[model samples]
Target: MTAPDWAESALALLVHRAGGTAAQVGSRFPLYADPDDGRWTTTGRGSWTGGFWAGLLWLRARHRAGLGAADLLAASACTARLAPWARADTATRGLILWYGTALAVADPGADALRARAARAALDAWDPRLGLVPWGAALGGERLRARADGVPGLVPLLTSAGPTGARAAGAHLRRHLELCLPGAGGRPRPSWRYDTTAARWAEDTEPGPGWTRGEAWLLLAVADALLRVGTLEGSPTRPPNDLAEAAEQLLESGEFLTGPLVPPADTRRPAGPPDTSAAAIAAVALRKLALVPAAPWAAACATRSDTVLRHLADTRLTRPTHPAGGRPGGMLLDGCYDPAGHTAPSHELIWGDFFLALALAALRGDVDLTRV
Candidate 1:
């Protein structure tokens, strides 16, 4: 069978495994739960809350399965209003807008939902610094300095439109000025914000060397470029900064080649090579391939193919360590520590969901080109 067929089957399985309903997944699980204070918290699972990414992934899966826009809107409304952890955080807002916009594009009725999401995104903004605060709880942290720059940017670009996109672009440009390494001409792999120092870190610190930091940036740049391309009238040019960043990520395969290395400060590795990161990279690489003679386009194409193949061939969706294994599949590798105090080491549904969407996009593109 072709890749698309395999992807379809995998998606179906995932939806089924996750209970396959339009309703949002509850925020409470073995490793993830809501704090008594209503804050979403993770134990050992990193970035696996039932917020925007997962909701968007579900919509994509349902769309591929022949679900209509109305169905998607219904599902999205459930996601937006029902998900217990759907607070005003970066991930939640990003997913809300991204998925909500997608729903709007499919069903005009979802314009309200889209508007709500956009408003939420806009409200999260900090006018003084002109950047969206990472979250209300984090005291208005910016994406560039928090977690990894890329993860924050991914949802931002995916959700924003002409006005919102431009605003996001401005904020990102400022972020690059402060956090980016080297001259402003090219993109670098890592960004730093010192929680201790309460400012952008002066040096490139991969922090115990989490591989996803680089991968997240690569995905974010690609996503930003794609959004910029959708603007009206004027021809869209791939941002030179993002193009350069893509090249750096592909070249830094040393970290991507194997399991994540444990930070020097810690004993265990973070987990695996973030299957979701690889999936996001694959889609981003495909988008990069659209640029004419762009130096990184070919490399991005090659990486996309390789990453997609690896995901299909390897049991990456399963657990990596003995401790992670259970009746259900083990969490894939490459996740940060969930406890926010230690390294992450469990299988997360969000990664699997996004990986499926990436595969679907790749397969869809290949099919479109073949015709």
Candidate 2:
């Protein structure tokens, strides 16, 4: 499919792949599929990426057919599995509830789920550190903060409605405040806020500014700013540092682009740039563009478009993925731990799901307020 036909073709393929996968394993949480063999694995609902497969189903069901009793059953099963996660065993409840359950199911009981999610987010907030602590109610050192955690928590709090939203926004603001100091110009990855020792240690892997972690930070902060504005019905002034931080990360995001923009030798590995991060930034930048407070809106949107086009091109997108897996199904070269080879050179469910999300965002079908 050409630029004009990309979304349609993408949607059609997703419907087919997801439908086929559903037929193969209904209501199973598909975490990742081997790009080489198309072998799928089922993870528990509480897994960090468990929501994404269901999320893919929900995204496609919006635009196509083949959804009936099976869709409802799948949705109900997902909700049932995720229901206990309201208090959230992990900080990824935002990922689960927003993607896995929010759009897919609408039973009246779902309201309780939303409330549970909101409470979980609130509970994760650490008053002293001013950011949500990572992990559950464990004792000892007791202060861990990850850039990725911000994304999964902010949406739940911002969407909490009249009760805790402003405070939730305040809590999100704290996360923005506590981001690790930048190296060259870009932000670093994570933080170990040792409330026990009252010291802060840079928590980036192999040093500062891990690729995917930085992208998560960029998108998470931008999303938080935009989300708070819509929730409180108040105008949000762009936090200059947060906005600039996003711009810097977007520059680093050039690493994801295939040598298009200048400064050619990014000096990283020279294959497919992390499409997972690129897809995420694409959708995130487009969403940021919609926010009046956001800066560099036009440039970010254009970059988003460029990433989408690159990802959609056959060289990157394994369009014929679901049927015959030949090491290039959907988006390829995903980096679970780029430095550590834990998840590399495969099509991650999150990567594929966000690629669909980026396409949907381009088509104006995504509701950032709801999603």
Candidate 3:
């Protein structure tokens, strides 16, 4: 009946899926589950989404139902295993570290691992680009950047205290500059500064304005701004101007509730509706309302509630797998473009994670932004 009830359901399902997923895929990092066949794919620590399983466990155990000692140990093991990824060349180090380091900071045993990850992020700074390189190639020929990197990257950087503040500030500024300008300097989600070609290129999706990328960039910026406000003892650089941050929150809120009601991969009518994007936007908007300079807070809150209602229904939600190992996958019809081909449109792990997070925020389970 209420958001908490849905979150409670999701919490139970997460635990069920965690146990079964561990049995099915073991500790090798369950990256994805085939929506139709229910086969799990393991990508080890290299995959960006790999941390979500451990993240889900931590969120379920810490925020929702408490896990048993054995499960907590398993979750802790996953965090320890991810330590090597701190030195990984990609921008997703934050994605890998967020849940783990958040857990680490809470559980005093993880201090060294947290410090290691902080150094990895510190090493990612590319002064030429004024931010960390988006692609793993780094100083190599291919120079790439992405909107998705910020949401996952910034938190880990901020969590490092003053050590990461200067770099985090630089990254956010570069990210905004890279937001390809539409008519009248409106920010699009992504663009490429082709260092090799010496020209700027627009980063596109199925069509103009990748809805998910836009949501990630804009909402993530707002989330970053929110973090700058609430950080107690940690030293974090203040993000872009308050007016600029407000503009981003306003733009994101407007786009999310715009004509493309159930936002798809692209804003186009023909584009496949990505319920995952909508879910991400829902959490972003809800969290956006909490930030200092954000306007239309009540309106944004209303839109996020509407989005969650849809996600809670049969349309975006898929039933738990008949056999097991998958449960209450919240947002359906997700689009992921891997190098070789487009991954199937199914429930994205981050989608489910954010949707549950949104519900948690709405029901006062977790502080979505500050965490």
lDDT of 3 by residue, 176-276 (tens): 77664544344465556876687657765433456777677666666676676433333344444633654654564355546423445434447556666
Q: What's the TM for model 2? A: 0.84
Model 1 vs. true fold: TM: 0.67
For candidate 1, the per-residue lDDT at 180 reads 43
Residue range 1-371, candidate 2, lDDT tens digits: 13358766665565566666666556567766666665666665547776677677766666553546666556556666677666655556777776666666455555577677887777776667766666653322346666666775677776666545654556555655555454554455556776568977766453453556656666676676576555456556755655665665666555334342121112354533465776777767777777684557787777777777777674244445555545333566566555665556666778787888777655555676456
Error of 3 at 65 (Å): 4.2
lDDT of 1 by residue, 85-161 (tens): 23446634453344333422344444455555555666666555556545543334344443243343444443555
Q: Order the candidates by lDDT, highest first.
A: 3, 2, 1
Candidate 3: RMSD to truth: 4.0
lDDT of 3 at 196: 67
RMSD of each: 7.1, 4.0, 4.0
Rank by TM-score (best first): 2, 3, 1
User: Which has the greatest TM-score?
Assistant: 2
Cα error, candidate 2, residue 122 (Å): 0.8
N/CA/C clash count, model 1: 12
